[model samples]
Target: MQFCDECGSMMKADGDRMVCTNEACAASSERDSDLEDQFVTTESQSDDDVIESTEDANFEGKPKSTDVVCDECGTQEAWYTLKQTASADEPPTRFFKCTECGHRWREYN
Candidate 1:
């Protein structure tokens, strides 16, 4: 018997596997299937992916865009976040809302 690391629930060892009694434990086989991106390192991934990851740290509290001229109302700037997709085939997008007019736009990465 073993205890679950996440919920501290009891688990029973069956053959080669240990299952928690909580019945909510995630199977290890499904963990990798939920990966948003397969690339692990910038040196080995595509240029776009590398650039996206580099910008992630700056997304925390950074302005939407540098010298970004709002096409709708000529606003000065806005705030944004680093939005990532499940894969490279997925769209690269970011939210940009006008601080003055509240007009939002999705800037694709």
Candidate 2:
């Protein structure tokens, strides 16, 4: 909302001074503190704000394998899980649960 006093054209803020847009009357002047087109500012937000949280996903599904046979029920399919029961250089131990009789067994590696 600032106007060039010399050219009577619109004035734009450029750093600390205001420049006229008119090509014929290229006038430049210092910025006014009580000008209409002063730098815009916003108020700081309050600290009291609501925070949101999310629930953990359900990771309870067990993987099934047809290769692992159940000893108690003689089933061909069973759910197996691996655990690091030995040293870091060795392989992990596999725990198997029968799908038919719900029998559990562990195999060390």
lDDT on C-alpha atoms for all candidate structures: 0.54, 0.68
Could you give candidate 2's per-residue lDDT for residues 12-107 as a string of tens digits?
A: 767778888898898999887776345542223452332211122121256777887787878998777676778999998776777787777778
Task: Please report the candidate that would top TM-score against the real structure.
Answer: 2
**Which pairs in model 1 have colliding backbones?**
36-86, 92-109
The TM-score of predicted model 2 comes to: 0.43
Best model number under lDDT: 2
